[model samples]
Target: MKTRKEKTGFRIPDLSRAAGPISSIVAIAVGLMIGFIILLISNPARALEGFAWIIGGGINSAKDLGNVLYYATPIIMTGLSVAFAFRTSLFNIGASGQFIVGALGAVLVGVKCTFLGSFQWVVGLLAAMVFGAVWALIPGLLKAYNNVNEVISCIMTNYIGMYLVNWIVKSTVYHQLTNRSLPVANEANIPKLGLDKLFPGSSINGGFIIAVLICIFAYILLNKTTFGFELKACGYNRFASRYAGISEKRSIIMAMVISGAMAGIGGGLLYLAGSGKYINVEDVLAPEGFTGISVALLGMSHPIGTLFAGLFIAYITVGGSYMQLAGFVPEIIDIITATVIYFAAFALIMRNLLQRFRLRKGGERT
Candidate 1:
């Protein structure tokens, strides 16, 4: 029977487990196609060259790869933040607020508490996590008890956090000349952990390792623990979880808190890179948080997938910068990123279509 089936035609592969990854790949391919079309319209003569750069430019040197890792670190944390909340059946738009608040807390410690010695950065990270958790807790509380929508509360908090940071920075750690927060203490910079030697002039640091470890930890927590199971159960059906004595309200609140803490740590990692970057007292919210949504969606809310998705975005960003050499402005990269994000939002639909196709194929074979 198997030989006869093979002689007739190739069998349709099982797509049940593979649907999510396959859809994500399709989304990426579509996004890239659209980006290439835009490039062709803008600069027909160099469109192919610019496209090549956008695809493989990040591998040109060790420094470029290192920079990709450096940039991926923070976004990975934020991606994990979004992914965690998503798994818990919650939307965490407040990641931006949590991130900025956490950054401020780290800065306050890094600047005012130099007496912490070599532990300044460590304390700063802890402060950032604490601040982020507290910031998220407000929305979690409102959502759990008052039946408030987290989206609205989160949006309000983003503006509040941005303005609050601006005001506080000017009062406490303001640098009059630069109009930004003061530089962190020398010891407050995250350790390079020999990444400087490995990357040769790249800003990569131990923070990348931290980000990777967190990803692994998150994967394990979500896949191997009873608590993780309960959180997911609540997400799938809160009333059912409650009937099972899972305390859905507690799970909801904890999920948001954990998500916020991750976002906060991301802010701390970015600012403490010791790369001479300082927090600007700007009116805009942190972009990393919003980008996290793209990463989570693209990764299908899988922790490991989110890590790779973050790296892919960073790789594309680095490649886009090189597009200038190919007669294309770097802003084209933004168009590409936006397009990818737009397509990523359709991953679920793609998955469903694939599953339906698989079912039809199975029925025919039977």
Candidate 2:
């Protein structure tokens, strides 16, 4: 019995996962480096000067910061819109259509109604939300009941919405009076929030505050509500959720409605912030909706993350213009942003590889 002896030892291997937000930041940095390198190959001197100019222009003053926030406002809303649907494993590819409908609804109310002051704004905002929700619901219902692919349906809807809004503007009294050729009414104009007084040249407005509040509210709704839990559960496993008595159809519809409402509110707020007197269907559709997908991914589908992503994108955009002014290609920012998105897609692959390596190492040690 005394001849037997045994010992036990343990080593604490790294148990932490890569910080997702930090990893995203690193990816962005890598993207920027690549962008700069590409520029260097073409024109080293201008590239260097352009980089400096971008940094300087983006943060040169408070007004610059305000402008970034201003641009961030709508994207934040649309990002939330996309993020909401993502939680239910649904891709809301129709945010562009919903956004247009929302703007059209709000503009119609804003111009046609004689209600002045705060009531006009409130009514207009509500109208936008209602219309936007309905617009999204069409595709949601189609996917739920008809088994139609939301992606295709949403894209078709986007085109239809654009044409419809354009026709409405042309035929309605809300048509622009400015040269008698313009298509939007002056009465529907969004009043400035005195940002002009604070920073005369900047387009910053109260909409920024509204965007932040909406983000906060969305975070709370998603994390602290029963409905949010249902949405998440359905997204995780629709079959399992259905077996557990969750109504898949209802969840799908609700997700789309909520998503559309967020986008609509964003549209309304953008107009209210003095971005435009009348909503231009084509102007708001393209980059706003497409960029939201990037924002949603970059933010990791979190409201706070979306806010930051929107700001980052706005920074690069505004900065890129400055770079162009300084004799470098402004498209540098676009390249960097696209590269970051591309790299972000590999995050899951990177995580799996790391896990496999860890497991293999553990097996050998044992």
Local distance difference test scores for all models: 0.88, 0.76
Q: Residue-wise lDDT of candidate 1 within 1-366, one digit each (tens)?
A: 223445779664545358767777777888889989999999899999999999998887999999999999989999999999998888999889899998998989999999999999999999999988988898899989998999998888888988998999999999999889999998998999999899988899999999999899999888999999998888887898999999989998999899999999999999888888888987889999999988888787899999999999999999998988998888888788778778877765776687688789879999
RMSD each, Å: 5.8, 7.3
Q: What lDDT does candidate 1 reach at residue 113?
A: 97
Question: What C-alpha lDDT does candidate 2 achieve relative to the native structure?
Answer: 0.76
- Best TM-score among the predictions, by candidate number: 1
In candidate 1, stretches whose alpha carbon ends up further than 4 angstroms from where it belongs are 1-16, 356-366
Error of 1 at 114 (Å): 1.6
Worst 10 residues of 1 by lDDT: 1-10
Listed per model in order, the count of residue pairs whose N, CA or C atoms clash below 3 Å is 0, 2
**Lowest lDDT 10-mer window, candidate 2?**
1-10
